[model samples]
Target: MAEIVELSEADQQRKDLILRNLQESLGVDKLTKQLSTGKNIHVYWGTATTGKPHVGYMVPMQKIADFLNAGIKVTILFADVHAFLDNLKSTFEMLEYRVEYYQRVIKALLSSLDVPIEKLSFQLGSSYQLSEAYTQDVLKLCGHISQRDALRAGAEVVKQVDSPLLSGLLYPLLQAIDEQYLKADGQFGGVDQRKIFILAEEQLPKIKLGKRWHLMNPMVPGLTGGKMSSSEIDSKIDLLDKPNVVSMKIDNSVCVRGNPEENGVLQFFRFVVFPIISPRIIDIKGQSYSNYDEIVESFEEKESISAEALKEFLKAFLIGILTKVQDKCENEELRNIMNHAYSSPPELDTSELSEGFQTVLELKDMGGDRMKEIKGDCELITSAKLYQKLNTDEPLKVLWRVSAKGKVNLGHLGGLLQLKRLQALKCECSILISDIGGFLDNGKCPWNALEARAKYYEEALKQFMKAISLENVPIRHSRENQYERDYTLEMYKMASKVTKDASAIVEGNTLATHLCPLYHALDVHFADVDLLITGEEQRPFVILGQQLCQGIGLPSQAALLFPKIPGMNGERMSSSNTEQHLDPLDTVKQINKKIGSSFCEPKNVKDNVALDLARLIIFPLHEGKEVVIKRDEKYGGNVSFSDYAALEASFAEEIIHPSDLKPFVTEQINALLEPIRTALTPQSKMITAAFPKVAKKK
Candidate 1:
């Protein structure tokens, strides 16, 4: 008995399209059912106006053609505003130019790909994004969503910096709302947009909208065997890249033996080449692969094609495939569009370097320039490392002392890894925290030194204290007699007599839990260090340090304050919650467990353990290196990433799952810790002997 499964016409087409190179589709089956009844489908996809469209970029363009062939109305959103927010490297004035360039280039790409141009509609983000209704919707969504959620949604698309802009938060909300205003029945984009699409699907109904289908295509791997990125020229073959450039990029691509799963060139052939130029047999010299499977099987065999041979075939195949696009680019209208987009904005005079630093460039030949680049703070002394951002002029000798009684954690050493990369000077110190209690150093204290110094500036501490308002002082944790009994008030009232602004006095705990400021201030002079690199939370400390500087006859603006590193859990990395911190000495299994247990909301990238590790560890440790993750072919196989941003983008799109990510990160963690592990053995023994981890009785 033979059994047959019957499929409706629309179901067959739907299954065909979705099962083809499609990664995931939400509501596609329903959309297909509707199509079977002859209902029209509205689909929209957007492109950022950041860089040149490459072959990787063409993947979606070709997909859009497929949608039109299926009788779907396609809307191409040229996201000008979104592009600007994401690409901080581009100037604001260039938005219009970039969008126009994007539109024309997209049109040319479609035309070259044989997609129907007349039926496709194009819209710029500014057209609707600035409208009152759209603006109101965006604001409404912003009000409902947490900053964490917004940040997570945009993590893949947004330009991640040490200090992300407010625009980053706004970008995701605007995108989610754009789906509402566009009235798209279905949205098509690269897999990276899956999170944002999910965001739209969840939030749109609450605000005011019909739900839309989410259709996503697999992201094309870059020439470097990672997600294709516009920023990395060597990682991609741009649509505008010449034959020589394309050849060079492909030639340099990562092509391991018998690994088509991670091989960008092979994946490109399966996804782009076979789909576009199909029905024609692919013949390489006398040998020929009858179909995509044959080719893949050949690559997957025990003794498959060599990397060099694959590259040579790819180099030629890509040239033949891109010939039409290259020819289209020669057209006057196309050339003019790109030229105008790249035209320079109005130029302004740049600021000159302060004084003779520019003229003394040759001083770099001498150690004077080296001395000029050294900078440090109290943290630096404890970190036992010098960083590039610390010093830039005049050599300053610094002394680092570790108290025999102070508690030392391996976590501090982990933090030093970043500073080490910056090429800071390294020094070791032996000082005790108990010895430096409230600036009263040891049984042999530094207080007498401070008191002796304070004699010179009798009213300096008071003067400095009075200048800052107690109402908004930095100390947050309240204690008994916080207001009435404190150094700040005593000093403020005393110094009020000297200063002009004498608003009624107020008081709060000056150095409540610790004497870090006093130690920091004295450490500046004791160590002969000038700059104190700290966080904004330590601003009040810096102020206190400034007062100490006055008392010690040192410069007031000694601390260079930067933002703190955010924790994987979205809190400050230095939070009292020990779970938030990762020690350098943690075993690979321990690291994996901690990260796996940490928060990772699907498609949400904010405060993500994996993303944080990528930024803080993987990228820094493996800079200019190729990192790969192995997976089954069904799960997109072994994917490689060139940088943290590329990895973030992939994670954001849901192309890489947390399960896959945790193990990969575990591998990387152990790899990074290997050398450090070996080097810290002696130090660990000393640290453990001096300061064992013991519970403090409350």
Candidate 2:
């Protein structure tokens, strides 16, 4: 600032509008002092011609509107040289084409916003930055600053790499000198360029150029919940996207109601929409409104808004506003400029181009390269070999060991739900109730209680399969099967085939717990399982099964591992924690209350029991149908998701609130358990025999 100078009332108002909606401002006193001198303040906003413009460009465009409305002189600088220095994102041959593409599109966007072109002008960075005086200032400023400081300045704007090009280091240096050469009173940009703004303010004084007012707009996150990049197609929506394409991009984006400021859709309303359109908003009912705070209030209150409704509003606005831009691009010359400039952008941060299917769960190949997938959850651990095997013409023979001990909880139900999913893919599944094998260390089931407990487990399994619409799957008890005549000879053959004793962990007081893993492994042989389904914690038994089969010269079975279900307390669910899981026989009130009380942290997918229930149970059951999440009218109306991936993505991004998530999961779980709870009512005698005094007390 030159000095303290008071502005007139009219110029004061102009200063306010120029500084509105900025995340940070530097040297505001300079603008006020200059405004008081009865002269129009000059401000410049620059853009590098690296990628095609997107909806994110609206932030700066709206800021430019504010400046024009304030009656200030604003210059829109197309930074062609800066773009070329940014790892050569724009080649010299295409710079002219890209610059032309930028000029046509920006003018169209500003015209659509009704910003007056009377006081607005355009400049190319090469026009002034190429002059000898500017060249002398660049070298003079270079001698005053270190390489580390220059790297720190452009760290936010440049594409970082191990050994960066010299052009990247000079990017921020040239931007600093651009302020003096453009002859502007201030530089306006996104808050992302604050580092360069600070450098221009600090290093410019060494060359004797005074500091200018630097204004910044809040950064709007990209569509997929990160910094929007032109190289990443899914993260940003292009400005020239068709109306239908705009709807599709906004529809596929995941949003939740956790933080109103962090959501890309909500931030769009605050930074771009509100400033241009004022408080006017056409809500879901198509009614006119002067107030739009209802969206933020709903997100903060008991009833949160639906992600679908808000996205629809943004979709309509974007489509309508882009109509002018897209329509103007239909000109023959404009189309030629776009085709020449963007025909072949360098592959920066793009997904691999592949012919075969990408791995859905981030699986790796034998060469250790990460495989891409169209979609998957956090629990998918597979290989190309495994994928090939599963897609073969042979029908899969799957086996799962059902425990005939303790209360049957949702943990058991989750595994069976996966078994139900496999049946649709020609899997012939067999449930082996392991009565003679591993049992809970608890005293609920003893040797005398084996028959009644096994019977109880079978009834529970039948009801679970029935609830998932499964029928006629084979069920057998391991104790009964072990007594068959051929089993005696098979046990003798199995004992001689292993490399070492399976009793390595037979220490005092926990002998059964150590030997249980080997016992479960041998069950694979008895069941003739071609593919095994179990929790990933049971992987040790699968490893032992492979060794046993190798010693006996039988083919080893492939394993499909799933992470353990999270408990109500947000820890691993266990039989030891009695209240941590929902039992199949729980009453409707109990089921709802238990699931509602489960820990469901907002935007935390890994530790949320509600999300696990949705991903593992609710979604798998509703495979072909849409899962509708009921929302209050105060929030948006109900929203339906076709697949769990979309739902999980929304939840992870906070587009889905935990409060809404818990209730929906509770409702689905109660419905799934209703029949199971009813079928187990008549079998009270079996529970009494299996659990003794414990069953009555619970």
Candidate 3:
């Protein structure tokens, strides 16, 4: 119910260019106001020269051309410094050459797309980034940015295969400052770069640089449907690909029928091909369409066009685009630049690791003996280098708590299963013997250990107690009584009292009786653990620890909370519930007997024990192999499922009866536990020693 405000012709055209293929816009009103006033707006977009320029690169480049047409001054940055920080596959020697290749190829692409090359300016990151002024700015900004803030900013673009690099943290800060240094009116990139752009818009004004508008293009999907990345060759079509290669890749693309969002082919045409090359002609079965819209409309309606026919049309269209672009890129001058760049190597900057801490270490490099040495360091690790090693570096050192609390619980055992999967995936996984029991020997009770650690985090603990006190109980809920009972105001009062009063630390009659949840929180900091794996039940305590630790300048550790596995009798599995639990050392026959007698409701997969075992244990243990169920000819023989979903669907729909499902699940369980049972044999003294002894009743 508001009056409409119209845009001027110049402003309208500017809006069209800015909005085309753009996912989101910030400061649009400001940008449009500037455009309407005929002020020259300068915009810059950049890319790392790590991967070969792919067709996906066309999205941003095409937009850059639109800016030039809109009478906006355009600058393109080749982010070589960012590429190095990102640890692109290229060696340091190849960065300069790679940048040259990017520039030349980008020029050819822009020219082919009808953008005015002469109107554009290009800048390499190192040109001004290495300057004294810029270096000072980067160092100055680092003081304001927390490692957690930096990490969150770069999360989308940075590679986080294992432990992330410190350079990754610096990457976003540099990118945010790039706009300030260039003195540009705006910056542009893919939607993934939005985080850094937002950070820049916030931080630039703080550093005395005016805020700039952000224009981001939608990420083009690979032929297989996810965002096209340069690292995944099969996922994307490289710019330099020959006509035959391009055609074949498109022909084999996974474009689901009638679904544009999931179909990479349709997305490419909508975002990339159509905007640049319109009035596209398509002839299918002797019928002619004037443009891409006609074909797409028919395809969506499921009338004339089919996926196969669409793929054929796509192959032809891509071949034409790639052929033209390839011809221009292969020009003698451009080829010479590429060849020169390829041959002339630059020195690799390996200094990022040498400075602070080596976060990434190849498990192979640190032989078994070295790993054993690390495992022996059960004492508190307070060194910054050691802290960084666990937090950010590769080959994540896992600490398996070997406490004398009792036999390792199912929750801890489940964590071990996850660790096994991580180890199999080439992650550094190791066990750490907890020194809590040993530390208690130095004092009478757990409070003594807590008091010793309390002096270091007293102020932070006080702040945490005050912070948590503000969270009022959900008194209105149906289960409010339970919540009030568990998290009482008096409990918080006690926590606050304990934070300040030394007398609150009490000596108990026994080591086990003296246990405090507060000690677990302290152990996290004392051990300098990066990631803490535990059951969901421990979430509140972990949150408490994280809140207190953050005040002490420590980042909250990432948590992987695996849900509690239900027992075979469809209840919480514990030693008290004998029918619900099965021993790890149970024989195959015993397991089969136990599972055959366990609960599995017909048609219901939710909280189903048999299915849970198949999901958590059997499937992960099999790792890509199918779980085959043998059946008689009359009942449908030899049904196999490649994944948990397929198996689950079959069971839910009653395609496989519970009578058949139970035995198959049991067999898989026995197969999974065979190796584990063997490792826990009497001869495996070290393995047996790792688990705490089960306490016996008097």
Candidate 4:
């Protein structure tokens, strides 16, 4: 048996630095005890061929290599099954190919680093014999937990009920069982998988296993922000990407000035590559030369650190990694075995020429015929690919066609139109009214058009209304108040207005009928409201909205209702309470209370209730426009007599009414306000005295 090797002073220093970097980057500690246990530590890593693996993979790959060098056996598992669960586009065959591809690449990467292949073993999860022990453990785990708890523990809440087959739910459990099968000391993944890892950890102890599973996660910055992903192309640099592509990607990567800590490229260097090289300074020097120009100068003078030189270095480094992987893939014997194993799946053999065989053959034939019959029933309407050229000279009349097979929905269509750079025309169809109008009239074009053939636009709208009503039915109403009825009536009124508008357009009697769906789609798609305030002529203009909400005492819940403009953070204003961390109504109340508390008290009568209200409500509502309220002390009342109505109408037309705040509106607003009301009792009392109260009936 191989004895664990002790590190030298220099090696120890490198190990410490690497572990520190990893711990900081991942916000987790390394398996220090595991490293010193004198046992072979193996790390197996593979990505399902969901397109190509990006730089996000580097974090785990580098960490695994670091652990391997620290005297542990590392087994890299290409989680082909997990990939199938995660990636919708990945087929079993494709997964097999991806596993092979990753195996080659991983091997090459190790070889280029001069890491020993003897200590590293790359294996496919699907190829590993399904351990009966693991299967029984999984069945036991399933039995121990309620279905709800199991679903919650598995992170299956976010997934739609029908989207995941039974296998998808079992995926996490299987992954947990993988630890038992592999006898892995630890597992590593992104922070998003924390729940899954925790489940595994919990389940392991119950199995009478004394060993605790270690989990290591690394921070991989995304293209826009937050966690990096293979899906977001700009967020990561692929190892296989060309030099120009890599340079452009890195150049465009988000960089923080005076804060090198979170810069994506710097983080990549610190976390992914720093621990591998013996001398840290040399690695730093290799990454960053004197300057781009100086590097160019050096390259011109001595062919060093030039763009070309760097490109060469990157290419060689990548190719060196890929070459070893490719060599492994070219291993005819292994390839043949994998091919045979995958092609001939170990399913029940019905080829014994028995009664069951005949029955299966007959069923297969019937199934084929039934599939053909179903295909015959379907009709192809249009063949317009998203982002492809349009033949219409009258501007693209993009309509929402609800085919069962169609991927693009009304929401998706709205998103697509927002990207088009064209003059949007009006529409004349009355049939296209609904939130579709809200999407269109918001300033882009009418992107929510019904297909000329589909007769379910109205029905779809009704269903949508029913869904919304059921989801957000009103409460907190006295029987006399008719609150629920009032809200329902208002919703119907809104729907009626939509129907009227759509009908008028459909009848071809209005200029609006010429409106294109593309423009409407853009309008709704980019409906986030941002406030632009111009200062003095010489001063730069200030852009504010959601950011200012917190400053003005807006509740966290309400503040979050306002969408974060792109580049604000990686996430949007999520309506999902779990994701947003607060209920929408609570958020609104928080904002209202915060603003009420922060309102500056002015000694002058001019800056009283009306003035303050204008500042607090009107200005913000008007997208930060300063407002003046006229009041007469003689009348003992205040009213806006200025062209404020017209200004507000225009503001509503330009901003408020067009903005899609509907999604963020909550039915429990009154309930949320109870706490705020209690907090502001004194203020409310004072304000009530200022405004005349209606006399009570006897």
Per-candidate Cα lDDT values, in order, are 0.56, 0.71, 0.61, 0.38
What is residue 318's positional error in candidate 2, in angstroms?
0.6
Instruction: Compose the digit string of candidate 4's lDDT tens values, residues 254-357.
Output: 54433445555445444554444424333223555433333334444554443333434434444455455445445575556445433532332222221111
1-698 in candidate 2: lDDT tens per residue?
Answer: 26767778899899889888789999888778788887777899999988888888888898899999898889999988777665544455688899999998988888888877666999998787666567546645654565567668878887666644445666788888888988999999988899999999998997798788799988778877767776678878788989888888888876676676557777666666666677455555454434446667764574455677778888888888899787877788998888899776443322322122255543226223211221123243333334544455556577778666577777776577667766765578888887655242323355457778888888888888888888768888886555443443233233333322342232222222333444466666678766667777766666665554444444454567766777688766665467877887778888778888877888888767898878777877887699999999787778789998899898888878988898899888888888888889888988888766543544
Better of 2 and 4 by lDDT: 2
Q: Lowest-lDDT window of 10 residues in candidate 1?
A: 470-479
Model 3 C-alpha lDDT versus the unseen true structure: 0.61
In model 2, residue pairs whose N, Cα or C atoms come closer than 3 Å (at least 3 residues apart or on different chains), thus clashing, are 255-655, 256-654, 256-655, 256-656, 359-372, 359-373
Segments of candidate 2 deviating more than 4 angstroms: 1-4, 286-293, 345-698
Candidate 1: segments with Cα more than 4 A from true spot: 1-11, 302-304, 331-336, 343-698
- Cα lDDT of model 3 by residue, 1-698, tens digit: 43344679768977786777688988787787777667878988988777788998888888887888777898999987777655334444577778988987888777777789999999998777665467545644654555456667888897653445445666788888898778788989999988898888877675576788998888988888788998888889887888788888888888776567888888877777676665565476677766556767777874676778777766776677667777877778767666665563344333323112233434443443333444321222222334455443366544333232222223234545655554543455443333342223222212223222222122222222222221211111111121132222112212222221121122332212112333444444444444555555555545544443432333444444556666777765553355557655566777788888877888888878888878776676567888788888899898998999998899899988888888888776665556545544443444244332445747
Lowest-lDDT window of 10 residues in candidate 2?
367-376
Who wins the lDDT comparison?
Answer: 2
How high is each candidate's TM-score?
0.49, 0.48, 0.49, 0.39
Q: Is candidate 3 or candidate 4 better by lDDT?
A: 3
